[model samples]
Target: PDMRAAEDAGARNAQLTKPPGALGRLEEVAIWYASWRGDPRPRIERPQVVVFAGNHGVTARGVSAFPAEVTAQMVGNFRAGGAAINQLAQAAGARMDVVALDLDRPTADFTEEPAMSEDEVVAALAAGWQAVDPEADLLVAGEMGIGNTTSAAALAAALFGGAGGDWVGRGTGVDDAGLARKAAVVDEGLALHPQAKDDPLEALRRLGGRELAAMAGALAAARAHRIPALLDGFICTAAAAVLEKASPGALDHCLAGHLSAEGAHGRLLQALGKAPLLDLGLRLGEGSGAALAMQVLKGALACHSGMSTFAEAGVSGG
Candidate 1:
């Protein structure tokens, strides 16, 4: 972050027409954005939303209420502009891209063995890294994959030191029996991949899916380019968590976009020390929550860059 730009933006905020601290978090949002953007007054002219889809072999365990085919089907929905993320991204004037990562070849079931080999995981990461647009001012990475929530829970538990029951949730509306099965699967994976606790990247390779790895890659690329990102729900946050666990402060450029209805999402955010921008009970991942939160960013930037200072308006200084 550019401390000089942040200082300038903070000073400008005090000079704005409104009373000091009137805008609350919006003021802080603008200043934070300015620091990353290196612009005392910045506008989000090019926001990009990339949704990556992949199939997870763990679906064979009946972890999700939906079948694995839904992953590919949803990618079609995204391309047709019929998904919730498409609408939200359009509403925010964000350029949307959907990448299907070898939908036919899902990751191995982590409960039985490592989810992906080193080569496969690296390929998935490369797909995500290449999907990012360096010119984009902001980024939101979303995922679509059957049983991915299971993968996410496993990754979270591995990186954060938790048991299966602590991280498992009813992903895709799984019933009680299915949820129990999912928890068992997570515990089994944890036992099989004990080394994941010490190596965050290994946790991703051993327990995460292609789409999850891709989200990690995309966020890393965003950080490299100094593009601020809005993180989505449990699955997305779990992917970002791996990056942070691997390298402290990896998520300094990201904001929690929302708190999802998923039971473990708030816990994950708390662990990451992120205060979400919204709480809309959203669990429909595909970057929908983050895309909606982008409007809040736009409003903040608008107020920061468009509003006149009291002096500029010839108003009396308070």
Candidate 2:
């Protein structure tokens, strides 16, 4: 957000040993850090991953491959440090915390009722923002919920209206029949809450999950704290869309970790005006993409700070 520091980084880049713009997006990533941090040698020493796990009432509609119980099970797994995000966080050397906002007791089905009450949404968001570690140098928000993609698609379709197939995806590797079911659920929810298309907070309360609201709250807090946040795949991105709708430019405090294989992820990224750091065809949630992308940021910082300039290397400019 600091253009002055970014300009200074650009000038420093031009004087580096490599030709200008040779490092590609890694250069841009380094500049992104330099711009916000004003650190000539910025580093992510205290990266953290905060995971919000919950259950969706829409799972009763037969949307995902996994049962809704898996939501609570996985939350237990996260608590025991046994989930994929746990391993990924350990590998990334980031502290991991799992917050169970609404576990086994699902929120009300959005097709039949609101996902959460206004008070619940407010409390979820407050919990999410409060989860952020002020001592952290970087933060990543991840979600774990069965049938969350359906909720994400419904929210995305309402915001960026289109056919159900355009926004829906095969969450948890659902088959054709399950995919159709998921799409139908989204279509039904969108039809039920057409007015939420114009109102973001309403959409979160209507179609989004408590975990999503928490993630959005974390995004807003990161923006307020000037801490760079890494966003996960579809569900996380949809949560970000909520924040962007509620407060414009809230996503400016975050970076997209990856372009997920989900149908609506790219469109959601476009809506947020963010280019993902990686595109490994990832659709697995649980903060895996965020964990993997942190390596890229560390790499960028290492190169930008460790490499010698042309003058220091005694190399003549061409």
Candidate 3:
């Protein structure tokens, strides 16, 4: 049952095939999973993507070119069966769940914005957990919220340990002026939540959007259920990084979907010691990248399970 033994078996299987490297990265991914699982055969079952939606506080400061109302509009779009996430999920044939999390809104009608209580955060997370099948083999978490990039940037800055400003990036099209304002907002938010200076949960409460906090909870639940989780884009990866810090070994089930244009996303991947499957300069959120990556994963698993080794195929190789 040793992974090394399984890898040896997989390599022999590849050698038996008619062409070398014909399968490209698929061959490598199959063998890697084989070794990781300690089995010649590995299967990815019950792939699901959870898209968490919420509102962010920084949007009130015009951090993004789009209006804050877009968050609710996009949510409705997702519910009505349109949007990039819907297309990507359909393409990947993954079950998609869209959850609406009621967090502090940048556009809330109040003299003072109310901070989300731990109980509300936990309850939202619990609902997210219930939305998916506990037996899913792979889970992908996506986020939808105006100004979430600002929230994610703030979380990344606080968690940067030493590299804060270097990791922050513009979300949803911001000009130079907007970027500066965004960074300042993140800096201020981090200062306001000193208790979360190094704490993930406190950071979530302080700088995280409802979608992000729920995404964290969903990831924790996925880990508890023993399912591999795929991270999509900047916000999702940032959320995963927070959850990882909170629970060591939680990232064992995580797969980096792609290298993102967001600066903080790159830093988070480096911190996590993960290599992304793709790098198309993708800046769009909604699990589009992760859903596309799942197709390659399916191909890899199919090759591992269906292909014959050189000996079995009666192919000759020097």
lDDT score, candidate 1, position 21? 94
Which candidate tops lDDT?
Answer: 1
Candidate 1 residue 302 C-alpha distance from true site, Å? 0.7
Clashes of 2: 0
Q: Measured by TM-score, how close is model 1 to the native structure?
A: 0.99
lDDT of 2 by residue, 1-318 (tens): 788888887777778888888889889888888777766567778888999987889988998899888888888889999988999888888999899985857888999988999998898899899999887878899999998999989888877678678889998989999989888888888888887889998999899899989988887887777678888999999988988877787687788999999878999999889999999998989888988998888788788878889999999997
Name the best candidate (by TM-score).
1
Candidate 3 C-alpha lDDT tens digits along 1-318: 246746675666556464777777777666655554556676776689888888866666777889877888888898888898898888777888898776334423111232356775677567767766786767788888888887787777766664336656777888888888776766666666777677887777667767877788788787667566678888988877787788776776677888889767887888888889889888889888888788778778777777777677677765
TM-score, per-candidate, Cα-based: 0.99, 0.96, 0.87
Full candidate order by lDDT, most accurate first:
1, 2, 3
TM-score of 3: 0.87
Computed on alpha carbons, the lDDT of every model, listed in order, comes to: 0.94, 0.87, 0.74
All candidates in order of TM-score, best leading: 1, 2, 3
Q: In model 1, what is the error at residue 215, expressed in angstroms? A: 0.6
RMSD of 1: 0.7
Stronger candidate by TM-score (1 vs 3) = 1
Instruction: Report lDDT (Cα) of residue 36, candidate 2.
Output: 70
Off by over 4 Å in 2: none
